[model samples]
Target: MNRIFATSICVILATSAAAAEVELSFYGGVQSAPSSDVSIRDDDSIPDGDFSIAWEGRSLEAPPYYGIRATKWRSPEFGYGLDFTHNKVYPENDELPAGYDVLEFTDGLNTLTVNAYRRWSSAFGEVSPYIGGGVGVSVPYVEVANSDSETFSYQLTGPAATWIAGASYPINDQWSVFGEYKGTFSSNTADLDTGGTLETDIVTNAVNLGLSFNF
Candidate 1:
């Protein structure tokens, strides 16, 4: 039993050490802004619960999106990856007047994902296309951006689903360019911590361009 346990521990440590030696900074991608139907409200103050106090999709809009990824390829046809991304925009309640919904980073969403993929080769390894899926953690801050006023924003987290498909064309043995489609589905509700709740639905369809390197 002791010998078997030692063998297992050695195998795990060897795998971890191999991963640590790989070039970690090797991929970057850019995509269009994500789309979500997210809104939050205060139930205590607004009895009607109409457009007068809700921020619609417009609040989640931001400029083009970019992300960094760390991936490991165990073989020529398979690999695992993790992604971190940020979309800088204010989450507002568009239903209210112009000035009432100007909260920044504190109300926006942050996405962290982990996934695995299998690459298919064709044309004598000249082309590689991949399909993958993973789960994501969608976190929304609970603090408001209003300086003069006080409104707290909190979120109840839920499962986020992701799917991706892409193709890469090698420029050389060390570099390649690729394009892909990615989508996410996450449904959650934000609590104002006052008297209102925001039904936040995040469903984003995006296309992306990526540059990859093997070092």
Candidate 2:
């Protein structure tokens, strides 16, 4: 994870140095996930089950929800960038299956994406509205504990995607504050310690407030 993050930062810095209108932004906010179906399969050491889990975001807790982005605009109204989000989910305790004691991705359901964005000038007085969408991959820190086995590791699960709608207010020529609604979808199929697999598809929605530096 450290190596991946470091490499991403290097790429962003290199891209920013060569870009005409580049912006770096950081955000923190509340996020939530609706209930989703979960499937657990194992040939030995655990029971197999298919059930629904009510996911809790607990965004304000330790390890929180946050995001960072770097954008390079080709024109005043259009741009593309890299966006990374640290998202998490916890299943309701009562929803756990017969053999499982813990199942959650509290550290991160992390996503790194390449997004395309479009902005409109002064749609609400001094505020400019923008929208974006992207496709990426999911790297989640899986935490699963059962009666007979446990697994805790980061795994590349599958494809992930995001869409955002937001507006910004310029604080100065080189700084701005923004708020946005962002949604992400991820499909995960992860390996278990018991030589089986767990699969689920998750959708997360977030409301974020952020600051940006433009050059």
Candidate 3:
């Protein structure tokens, strides 16, 4: 199986006869945290401890996202690339436990994704309007504050499906900039491993601006 996959890639590189120059891009920008569903179990009851979400999660601020992408244009209108980007959001508010009025909370969700995308671009004078999409998995990290004032933590290790869309313009032969939106959908909201069961789907949508180099 590994040999067959390797051979397929080799065939692609070899048959890239009509390929344009490969493009390497780096970008950074802000992402609006998507609305998520969250819940925390206050007790331990095995596989049936009321596995349900009770809170809707939202971001108090826009988090930052950044990444690098390498694309191979097989032709002027068609191309494929490997894209890796990061998008994250922090917990803004928490429903306090019964007696405590404050949780002194400090935690957030961080997602890093590696994706494969197909893109189509059209040229109008010096500007190129393009649309593309990718399917990938997002690796999420849930950080729960553990301190004297805080008393819980969590560890998440899994990949969730992700998607993206965007467009870009060429400033010159070697330079270009782009604006794109990315969405990362997760399946962790149903069951999260934490001090308590912290249930929240870490979905995100980010608008990014980046620079590209053709080499």
Candidate 4:
């Protein structure tokens, strides 16, 4: 029994050391001002509820986001790799002026992204800095209702692009804290059943902080 326990401890330590080189991180944090302007008309406007507010609004809710990354240290100075994430934009409600009975302007944007980057580190515990870009497809799901009419539903999806730059600080071999600033650019054009088209351009900026595991 003592021999087995000793072997297990050795294995665990070995795994932790290995992780210091190749890392996999999982994090969830809050990002604000990560939205665009919604123009319901010429005079009325509202801010978009991006991934930072997907689940709910007006509370102490920390928007959740998860991603996976792989890194290969080239020297003590540089490294590169790939990453992916699924993010959401919350839904909002707005009422049109009198004579118009639109119940909700509830629309959301969900996207998937792929990115590549390079890292730069210095002696102060290592700063893995990187910059890379990616493409995503934005899908918008919308629902609308009126007093005397049945509810209407529809969806729209379009392509998008993004650029990111950030750094990570190693607290230890297998654990670290990181922050990233990402910018997303996209557009949407849809024809309303009521006649005419709804067109929009979207821009989002976000910052994230959380735990990262090396290896």
Best by TM-score: 2
Which residue runs of candidate 2 sit more than 4 Å off their true CA positions?
A: 1-4, 93-95
The estimated TM-scores of all candidates read 0.63, 0.94, 0.62, 0.55
> Candidate 1 on 25-85: residue-level lDDT in tens?
2233333333344455653442223232222233233433444455677777777766544
Ranking by lDDT: 2, 1, 3, 4
Candidate 3 displacement at residue 128 in angstroms: 1.9
Show model 4 residue runs off by greater than 4 Å.
1-23, 32-108, 123-125, 143-156, 189-198
Between 3 and 4, whose lDDT is larger? 3
Clashes of each: 9, 0, 0, 4
What are the lDDT figures for the candidates, one per model?
0.53, 0.89, 0.52, 0.47
Name every residue pair that clashes in candidate 2: none
Regions of model 3 farther than 4 Å from truth: 1-20, 41-64, 93-120, 146-156, 189-197
Point out the worst 10-residue segment of candidate 3 by lDDT.
45-54
What residue runs in model 1 are displaced by over 4 Å at the alpha carbon?
1-64, 87-100, 103-108, 123-125, 141-156, 193-196
lDDT of 2 by residue, 114-151 (tens): 99999986567888999999999998888988778889
Relative to the true structure, candidate 3 has a C-alpha RMSD (angstroms) of 8.0
Q: Report how far residue 144 has shifted in candidate 1, in Å.
A: 6.1
